[model samples]
Target: MTSEVTIRSIQAADTYPLRHAVLWPQESIDYVKLNQDEQGHHYGAFCNGKLVSVISLFIDGNVARFRKFATRPDCQGQGIGSQLLRRVLEEAREKGAQRIWCDARAVNENFYRAFGLEPEGNRFYRGTIPYVRMAKSL
Candidate 1:
């Protein structure tokens, strides 16, 4: 998969498009909320220097909570999510995080489980859809 993919932190200028392309497609993503409370770390995956996926990690104490993880629809099946997740998890471990956790979209539990995460509790709703709380010890 030497497709010249690079993973790095999000740039401020990419706030809007990255949100639209990844976080919320039909409804507009609220960049203002982030501007007012920028409390997380965001990572962007690039293919040939063009962004193809985005993942955000919200750190709270010793845990890292991943959020808004999305890969370009066209690139979804090609392992971009897996790669980005691997890097993000590694980064968390390096940063002294004792645990890495996330609200995995209901349908994506198997994918997260493949990386050794275990469901910690019952599914919870985010807006309307449900998500599972998955966690792994770093």
Candidate 2:
């Protein structure tokens, strides 16, 4: 079923809770906080007035990198994350980003591929989980 979701720019701190809950529940909350968060554009998807998904965009020169993208387990498969990502990509392009990329978890490679991001370089592991660098031109 589809839900009424709103995607909006939010402060970096606002993403911590959701990011920790969905992306790194087994690790300390601090583990989900990125050092470069303050230099990025943060967006959250609110469904039924509750924050259900979030993504962060960091731009350096013409390249925009998004990290810490996550959706609450119960909210996964509802398209909230996809909507937030599309909005972020559009905003990045509007801001003159020539390329957008992320180190996507191996399992999520197909998801990013759906949005035109292709795997680049060899796969690496963050802890024991595998990841691949993915990118696409804006």
Candidate 3:
């Protein structure tokens, strides 16, 4: 595995394919209806030019709302997601975000906890998929 991982802004071409690999087939996101430009800030982790992980941030007032954080299944546990997360947070802070937030899958709550995110709101369902809204002060 190449350890030359890179995090950078997402191109539109990367959005659809990654959305399928990450969010589709789970009855969660309606990827076919998504418009990346209107959605949020998108970032990707590239290993030797291959996209292995992806995350997004949407700025609203003093907060940066995270969206569609995903690492390719083959890349999980190798810190690709962590790299993506850290870069997103750094970008958020640079943009003057006072807080950062995301709605995480219940099963992956521990991952967010590692970054200091805590459940700060009620659970929400997107087609029966459970998510907990988490927030962290930046």
Candidate 4:
């Protein structure tokens, strides 16, 4: 079935449940909470009125970084995450952000590459999960 999906700014609290569900199910919900959340702009994708995808953008002058991006497991491969990323990128550019970056899970490198985000350093591990620093010029 087709559902209407809308992307919009959201409060930090709105992202915690989905982040915990999709990105850190084995850990407590607090595992998904970031100290910088209060200083960032959060965005969510709502599908048929339910929040299904979330991303946070933290800006520092002309540079911006996104963290804790996650989409519900059932919603993966449906392009909802990509739509949310694109919207945030546009918003960042409009706000005069010159660079946007993220520490992306290594497994998802190709997905970020499709959006022009290039890896800048060697892979690193956060606990047991591998990640790479990826960035794009806005």
Judging by lDDT against the true structure, name the best candidate: 4
Worst window of 10 by summed lDDT in candidate 1: 28-37
Clashing pairs in 2: none
What TM-score against the true fold does each predicted structure earn? 0.85, 0.97, 0.88, 0.97
List the candidates ranked by lDDT, beginning with the highest.
4, 2, 3, 1
- Looking at model 4, the pairs that clash are none
**Where in model 3 is the C-alpha error above 4 Å?**
26-36
lDDT of 1 at 80: 84
User: What does candidate 4's lDDT look like per residue over 1-138, in tens digits?
Assistant: 288889999999999999898888999998999999999999999998999999999999999999999999899899999999999999889888999999999999999999999999899998999999999998
Candidate 2 per-residue lDDT over residues 15-52, each given as its tens digit = 99998987778999899988999889999999989999
In angstroms, give how far residue 58 of model 2 lies from its true place: 0.4
1-138, model 1: which lDDT tens digit per residue?
668788899854454576576656766666323542377777888998889888777777788878777788877888887899999999888877899998788888999999999999899996777889999999
Stretches of model 4 off by over 4 angstroms after superposition: none
Question: Please, what are the lDDT tens digits per residue for candidate 3 over residues 1-138?
Answer: 557998889765566567666676554345533454565778989998898887778888788988777788888998888988999999999999999998899889999999999997788888778999999999
lDDT of 1 at 3: 87
Angstrom error of the Cα, residue 8, model 4: value is 0.8
TM-score of 3: 0.88
Q: What is the Cα root-mean-square deviation between model 4 and the actual structure?
A: 0.9
